[model samples]
Target: MANKKPLILVTNDDGITAPGIRALISVMKDIGNVVVVAPDSPQSAMGHAITINDTLYCDPVKMTEDADHKEYSCSGTPADCVKLATQEILHRKPDLCVSGVNHGSNSSINVIYSGTMSAAVEAGVEGIPAIGFSLLDYSLEADFEPCKKYIKAITEHVLDKGLPKGVVLNVNLPKLKEKEIKGIKVCRQAKAHWVEDFDKRKSPQGRDYYWLTGEFINEDKGEDTDEWALSNGYVSVVPVQFDLTAHHFIQDLNSWELND
Candidate 1:
């Protein structure tokens, strides 16, 4: 909180070259010194995977002709990228770590499988405040201009007020024009899930294969949830915790007749 600009680690699941991350970097640069260490290729839905057996190769690269920020492309998952950045790349702990501006929504139950959120969670595990951002549009050419201003505001807020330990933010922007977008909304994650099915098929070698297919179903009608906020034209900001403990069920589990 001194005169020096904060160091911000920028990363994403949608590869280093993805437009989403590029847009994210533009916003982060305005707030702090940025160091980008992201996947060299798309690693969406990869969860919190880390590279153990295989070799991780990370090298600095220039993304644009006039680029001034430190950028590195890594051959690893989003989680691995954070680990490498903290352990090997950056000389000091970053003031904050930010992921995504992802090509699609990472709201509701999708968080479990999101590489974007996983990176932020990984940062949280390392005692760094973090946030993961996403947009409703899944297209590579999704218009990101409308979301940049909100992203800047949210990032500035997080920088001002550090997040709680073990907690990070999951932000989702609706695909709407800048003027049509409602203001930011702090909400809880919706109770939603995918009713998934695989499409069976045959390859050219006559081998069987299956492609993943699913429909997202939102069972909760609560208006205070992330899904509802996004549906109603606001940017959804959900505070997420990396802890997976089922603390509420511990008391009930103790009542089980185990000695009988």
Candidate 2:
């Protein structure tokens, strides 16, 4: 008897109908049995957030005429979509879980706030092989053509060779044409941060509000970093883990005199 086709769970932070996810769905359909559970609305920058105070809802959605795949839209964050998919939607554990093809880049420190990576990270926490893909372009109509081939290739590779337990992939593609791309590069996450600024304003009714904005500062100059890979026109693939423990400082922490 032949082995069953891989069960691939599809999701994104840009909502189910976004072009980026549609492109992702198209590619996954050719590779395996794809099932999508994503936010009903864009959930960008909602990092690892789940619904606790409110009831969650997930309903089947028909975004395309493709009969080979199933899709659902959830009224929750990207992370919640993953949890709900695995626990309630899927009949069995997915062979692999994939998030994004996000409209904007989730590289460097952005991963800490990205709903795309959060979804993938949630899957990793569940011991599933997962990946989150993103493009540098942020436009709602950004061309995703250059990313399709690479996305399919990377997904196929992950399905063939499972990721290490607790580690998920954060893949960021440069905003370059397919011919201009230098290929994929596996690298470490760069040390970077966002410097925020808030613009204060008053409405006609005298209510004041502030709009938040920031600039990304990349302080790491290493060639083996995700920042360098994306800057050099390569698709950066960073292995991200959910473990937040600073293991290297454990010995130093133990040496501190606490009972004194």
Candidate 3:
């Protein structure tokens, strides 16, 4: 008997109409059966947050006149979309889940705040092999043509060789042309952070407000890091595990004299 088509779930932080997710959908269409459940509006930097205190909505949407595939516009975080997709939307658990092809970078320390990666992490928690993709460019018009081939390749590879439990891939592509991209590299997350500054101002209504601004700081000089790969024209693939346990420090922590 021939093998059944793999069921794939597609989602993003940039809403249902973003060109990035469209590119992702186009690529995924060739790979397997795809169903998209993404935010109705941009939800960048939402982390792994899920809606609790408010009503969540996920409704059918038409992305294009000729496009044929199940699509839903969700009123929740990226994580919430994944939860709803698996629990209520999809008829069955997806064989794979992919998020983003985001309009900006989710490399280095940015993954902790990325709704893109969070969706992938959420799928990982449900035992689904997942990947979050991003481009370094912040432009809405950024060319995603270069990313399609790699996306197809990586997705096929994952389907053929399933991922380890509790792990998901965080992939970031440089903003260079297809020819300029050296290759894909498996690397570590570079030690990096955002140094934020808030612009405090009074609104015309006499209320104080703040807008966040920051500069990215990359402190790690290691060549085997995502930051280095992206800087040198390579696609960076970081294996992210959702486990937050500090296992190495557990023994030392237990030795502390807390009982006294």
Global lDDT of each candidate: 0.96, 0.91, 0.94
> Which regions of candidate 1 fall more than 4 Å away from where they truly are?
none
Q: Candidate 3, which segments miss by more than 4 Å at Cα?
A: none
Clashing pairs in 3: none
What's the CA error at residue 228 for candidate 2, in Å? 0.7
lDDT of 1 at 81: 97
Task: Provide the clashing-pair count of each candidate structure.
Answer: 0, 0, 0
lDDT score, candidate 1: 0.96
Q: What local lDDT does model 2 show for residue 1?
A: 8
Q: Write the per-residue lDDT of candidate 3 for residues 118-172, one digit (tens) a residue.
A: 9999999999999999999889999999988888888898998999999999999
* lDDT for residue 70 in candidate 3, whole number 0-100: 91
TM-score of each: 0.98, 0.97, 0.97
Range of the 10 consecutive residues with the lowest summed lDDT in candidate 3: 1-10
